[model samples]
Target: MFHHRERRARTPAHETALDCLEAGITAALPKEVVSSTVDLDGKTFAVGDAAYDLDEYDRLLVLGGGKASGGFAAALADRLGSRLDGGAVVTTNVDTAAAGPIDVREGDHPTPTERNVQATAEILERAGSATGETLVLAIVTGGASALWCAPATDLTLSDLQRTTDALLASGASIDEINAVRKHCSAIKGGQLARAAAPATVVTLAISDVVGDDPSVIGSGPTVPDASTFGDALAVLDRYDIRDSVPESVVDRLERGADGELAETPDENDPAVAENEGDWHCLANGRTAIDAARDVARERGYEPLVLSSRLGGEASEVGRVHAGVAAEIAAGGDPVERPAIVLSGGEVTVTVDGDGTGGPNQELALATALELADTGTDAILASVDTDGIDGPTDAAGAIVDRESIPPDESETARRALAENDVYDALDDRSALLRTGYTGTNVNDLRVLVVPAAD
Candidate 1:
């Protein structure tokens, strides 16, 4: 799926990293994930471990939003066939022909727009129409928070956009960002489940969070919320962006914390309690990490899954990973030579400069600096499995010891400091581009260490 594979795969190590990435991403593709996790029998429909009697429910409706939702919705439509009734799903990618009976509507990401708001209304309306006999299959995945935008009472689309911009720029974690977003939206944090109350809602999700907490994934539209308005406000305060966000957002959060407004549904809420066990995480970062590890073994390299729940600043994480690779390369202390170290998690970039680059690019660039400084021969590559990194067309970047030449090391460092690694990586033909891979299992990093001569 990488468009510039020919230009980027300069060595065996580079090719191995790319292979591992492909294997990891392919394992999490919505269609592949669904085919393995969901099934239909004579009269029972199964997703994960949950089974529903098709004869008991009068109608089965699909609803959700995310970067991966289009492929997921389409796959579900193909799986359910005529047994499935019509439903709406908002996503950045639209494939009407593939979506079959499901309405795959277009929506924006990173920031919510009027289009997202309107599309979300349709989902909420359809969900609200469900009866006790109706089965609602909520397909929540990464980016759903933005695609499933539904501003709360007295909130406008502009209000949400402004608040989202502030939170994104504040370097807040996904959990922290979703905490604030859930309180400001009408369908997030179990509100969608509340709307479809008594309808036997079942959430089939592809997790993008570090822990795969259903509430944090897609802001928990079909699951109970563990965060509160007080927690959201605390997140803003922790990031020191309380004053940076819109006044309406602060006011709504403050009021909700004061008990003037109802909080997002909790476990005690009847709607959430009824569907407690119905939420299932079909695939997550670990899923991708494991698949990549299998590829490493197949390629004759001893694979080490460093950690599947990695977190923290992207550049810092990159440096630490580089240190580990250096250890393996120099003394073979970690796992001996010819090792492949794989990890998956969502790393954040505290955006300070106007330069364009995503977390994966930043991490890869930072790792390149360490590898160059230590003269490590290992090849390091990182990518957002969704295929888009930051606002750039490149999924991420691949780097080796020579990626940043001795003469250009300072310039490369400056580019990273300015959040401008995209152009720098592009100049070296190191940018890894794979247009939308139709899935997001957070960020995947691969370190391919060659055998010692």
Candidate 2:
């Protein structure tokens, strides 16, 4: 829920955008998604179309790490109750009282820390201890790439941290960045599944990636990796951050690519092949977008879902969306007046300056400028579904023509140029802050356009 709903809902249009966002995030909550997707009847355990006989397994262990893993673990813990044999999961945010019996540990996000390494080691240890009769439930979600940190041999936590920074600043896509990360770590790229080999490893995931690719979600700890070490090296080369990244990272990726080190398990690998069918994506960007669309229709607005797989530089994407709004306001080609345009996906921001703001914030800022320049009458709101955008505490931002008034247009443009949209939005009280929403299905944006008087 929004922290100060009244203050942010400045107009009826703004209120509609907020309502859609809330509904979309609420639909993907782990508690809500898990209860509907997973069920237990006596010894029978069901997830999606697959059902397992719990009595057949000697032990049931839960292991995972991510932004949403805590909530997911808690929900599962409530379902299994005494049947759970106890396990651990690392998260950036967690409600201790709601965690039931699962050991919920805190970790850093967007960057790996010593605490993350320690917590992840415990998870690997528990996963490695699984026997043939053990049934392992892995909760993989957004942010696990950092939460489940376990450096490969000869790599240090600092090495990973530096690499993470370089990759993030390089404007690499999540898939590309994760390809590099998977090779530099021991627990990613199907390695967790390897550690829990022979045991039935069932992965319950909340997809935050563009296409819901299992291998890319949480770096595919439980699924087979389609990328190779060569792919990682190529990503670094593509970004031209090879020299900027830690030498140790380059060495590890190079060694793996040269076959001096074993590659991440592919589809043929037994670690993943055995229980490959057990990977389940409980919710995704489409799930959020559709839920938001339903809310838009309920508000008497014709909703047009742009795409759930949108990608590219954030500011450029914002310009495209602004163009669509201008067209709809003029000719109403895509949809008639009084329409709500929606899109959900992860967008990248190429940080060229030492400015603060996430992709969603940058996008909203750019949209405001474009809308004002073209005299388009519309209101746009964007937020990371997880309730945290970039490194800032704000969820994202909201903008309209007045967001960047004529007198303040120069200041707003300067902010976007410096990648500091967070401050600019804050100046206008346009920043959308909602602590931690306990769910992540990528970024969600809603644009509301009203009919001409």
Candidate 3:
């Protein structure tokens, strides 16, 4: 039997899956990951194998924004207390109180509002004004693309707003969205590092993007970017987004892409070629997936990591994962019965209608309906690391066959069609609300396939 109802009470298997996902997200944001990856061992900030003596640096200034910004910043404040003078960071929902020198600024997310812009500006200014004697520590995490929105000189906020909406609706990948963002922003794609030149800039980052490309995470304000306006235009054209986007956005792209366009710096760009600041990736998909594996092991379930960098449309991804779970229960291609399947990485939704949802919730609903057979029990939970997903209050959804109503297949299809996965799951109490976990290791998904009785 493939489809069976599950009790609402937390099963041993359920609790174990949750704990593993939580541990993975938590482990990815700790100081050990940050300090080690960024090469900020003790006082020395290493670039490649060479370490720079930072004894001359007077104060450590922490700055940046993201979903995991607050958690990562808090860890840094605790670990590097006293050395940190005063720096600002913004996150969706995090307890940010600096007992010492760190200054925490709470802000909105998922979309760039005026308030989020204001709070993030203070961080950018503080980092930009760093003296040669100061160590400007940039704690970057996911959701930073929306949390930290500062448009470039050529692009106005209104222009950016319109463009961002179009891109999100177009179901473009994060990399595609960020290509336009790097061109539109004043503090992305190494521009922030360029602004903080002559000072030591240490970027402590968490990778939410596939392949852990620094330039794609939070648009990589501290990392050198290889993408260009032309690249962005290609994306717009690929998604037929040119006509839908704002007029100014098109003008800027045309101006910037043509040889008349001020070119995005080439690989041998003078800014990075001359400046000496460094970047590091603290954690990523592996961190969360690995945690899920350990949790599955402890719970006496065989753990199968499907893939850490899962991608494509949110609902489509769910169907594929559902197919995999079914395989484990029936075919057992990778592992046998009583297995827990885990995956990490971001999934996106195309806003086809005015629906409230996130990728994870869409994933859950799709999986639930697809696996609605009998005799077997399956549970799928997908949640965003930062908490909020899409326009909904919940990050994502969790559902077994029992969670769905009798009209589930039709309802699920409708919700998926309108990009309203969160609401569809909301009625069933399937939405998982953590209200911001303080860290953004991207998206974590757990697919449980119980052993046949």
Candidate 4:
């Protein structure tokens, strides 16, 4: 799915890295996962290994929001066919057409917008209408936290927007950001499950968070919330953005912390307790990582999956990957030469410059610089499995020993300092752009080293 496939396949190692990257991305596609995991045989419907007798339910309603919700809903609709009742799904990518009875609605991502609020309202409405005999198939995936935005009654959309902006800019962990979001939102933190009370709410989730915590994914709209408003306030304080965020946000969080506002439902709450057995995670970062490793081995490289839960600052993580490559090159301690080291997980970028780039791009650029400094000949490729890195059009970037010219080293250093790796990489045609890969399982990175000469 790499758009610049020809340009990226400049060498044997680069081609292999791209192949592994494509394999990971393809394996995580929502449609493929959904179709493989969800099946229907007459009245017997199964998600994963759990089976639900369709005859036991009066109606089958779908409710969810996320980057992959559209594709997931479509795949599910195809499986359920005429047996499936009407449903609603909110997504960041609105290009996909609605299928069966699912209404695919447009929403925003990374940040919520007016359209997102409207779309989420409809989803909540659908959930609220569910009856005890209704079986609600809830789809929760990456980016749902933003796409399913519905601020609490005391807070306005603008308040949520400001708070979200501050949290993203602060480089806070996804868990922390989601902790705050669950409290500030009306539909998050198991509130959706509460709204669908008495109904059999079965959540089908594609985890993007590092640990695949169901409560953190989409802020746990269909699951129990372990975080409280006090916890949300603490996150803001920890990030030092408490005073910088909107006054409405601060006041609401303070009220919630002071017990003036009802907290989001916890695991023991009635809504969560009643439907505790309904949640299921179909795929995660490790799913893609393992698939990539298989591909690497098929390509004749000794695949080493370093970690599926790697985290930290993008540039810092890049240095760590580079260091590992250096070790492998020098003595092949980790694995023999002609090894493919793979890792998957989300990384953050503490944006200090106005430069345009995402975590994967910054990670690739930083690793390229590190490899050049240490005279290491290795190929590094990083990409967001969703095919979009930050706000840039490129999925990520790829770099090798020859990616940066000897004379342009100083110029590359300046770009990296300014967090403007996009321009630098784009100039060299190093950016890996793949429009929209129809799935997301965090980030995928591969380091390919040829046999020692």
lDDT of 1 at 279: 90
- For model 3, residues 1-453, the per-residue Cα lDDT tens digits are 001113323676565556665677566665546555444567775544546576888877888788777766777776665556878887876565632466667776666878777886887788768877877877778888887888777677778778888898898999999999888888887777777776777776787888988788888777678898899899999999899988888888888888666655445755554443466666887887887788788878898888888888888898887788778878776888789988888888777778777788888887888777542377787888766677767767777767766666687778788776666776777777766666677888888888776
TM-score of each: 0.99, 0.98, 0.91, 0.98
C-alpha RMSD for every candidate: 0.9, 1.0, 3.7, 1.1
Candidate lDDT scores, in order, read 0.91, 0.92, 0.75, 0.89
Lowest-sum lDDT 10-residue window in model 3:
1-10
Clashes of each: 0, 0, 6, 0
Candidate 2 residue lDDT tens string, 1-453: 887789889888899999999999999989989988999999999999999999999999999889999899999999988889988999988676776778999999999899999999999999989999999999998999989999998899999999999999999999999999999999999999999898999999999998889989999998889899999999999989989888998988888889999899999999999989999999998888889999999999999999988999999999988999999999997999899999989899989889889999999999999999999999899999999999999999888877888888898889888898888898888899998888889999998998787
Q: Give me the runs in candidate 2 sitting further than 4 Å from their true place.
A: none
lDDT of 4 by residue, 252-291 (tens): 8888889898888887788877877888999999989888
Better of 2 and 4 by lDDT: 2
* TM-score: the better of candidates 2 and 3: 2
Model 4 score (lDDT): 0.89
Show pairs that collide, candidate 3.
1-374, 1-375, 1-376, 2-374, 3-373, 3-374
